[model samples]
Target: MSGRPPGAKSVDQLLEEARSRITRVTPEDAVSRMADGAVLVDIRPQSQREADGEVPGALVVERNHLEWRFDPESDARLPQATGYDVDVVVLCQEGYTSSLAADALRSLGLTRAGDVVGGHRAWVAAGLPTTGGPAT
Candidate 1:
């Protein structure tokens, strides 16, 4: 231990704590909601998306720009980020980053923001729809 503090948190600890604060979905459930108009926001970088394919029709909102792209009041927000109540499901390569992304979105008043439990890898494993093309 570095002994910085008595209550210091590791990265894994932080990740688990973040996940515990939100509702995470399975790949199947995410697809079901996507079909029902819930926005599936992919936060993986473009290179990762190209390397392993991506959920077809999912919005590609790179992690770095997530706050600007999802915050409704921001001029940079995507049009689909309509309001605080919009159902948004964030996805990363392996589900880790997504939890943090969803938690951030929730902090921005997007109450329904959540992450796919196992991320895009799980989605592919579940045989969900995916496309191998340039990031949109």
Candidate 2:
């Protein structure tokens, strides 16, 4: 007995589904992967990144164009979208959106894609390398 659109999954359900499909990394772990040549992609909008600060080497790919820019067969793909085996770590202001983005990337055949747990905020907290970013 709810006044709502049919077949609309709640955000909670969506989050659960997304997280189940990916192994999210901690901020420290993310930095470790970076050392090993993984790509840390920050999907937070420009405004948020400017406001909070940024991870120095993290690529700002934004959320909307991720699929196209990361798809191996797409012309819009970024140079870092090297191949299907590349480790792509998605990040946002928090962990939530990155989970969804990681899942999306996986669906696009980026099997190694994942997210940074707690996002940039956690990155800052762990004393990882970032520039002009959030105050942890």
State which candidate has the highest lDDT.
2
Question: Which lDDT tens digits does candidate 2 get at residues 1-136?
Answer: 7675898888989999999998899998988899999999999999998898999889989999999999999999999988898899999988999999999999999999999999988988787777775455
Q: What is candidate 2's CA lDDT for residue 5?
A: 84
- Candidate 1 accuracy as TM-score: 0.91
- What lDDT tens digits, residue by residue, belong to model 1 across residues 33-79? 88888999999998999898978889998999998998999999999
lDDT of each: 0.89, 0.91
Model 2, runs deviating above 4 Å:
134-136
Worst 10-residue lDDT window for candidate 1 reads 127-136
Q: lDDT of candidate 1 vs native?
A: 0.89
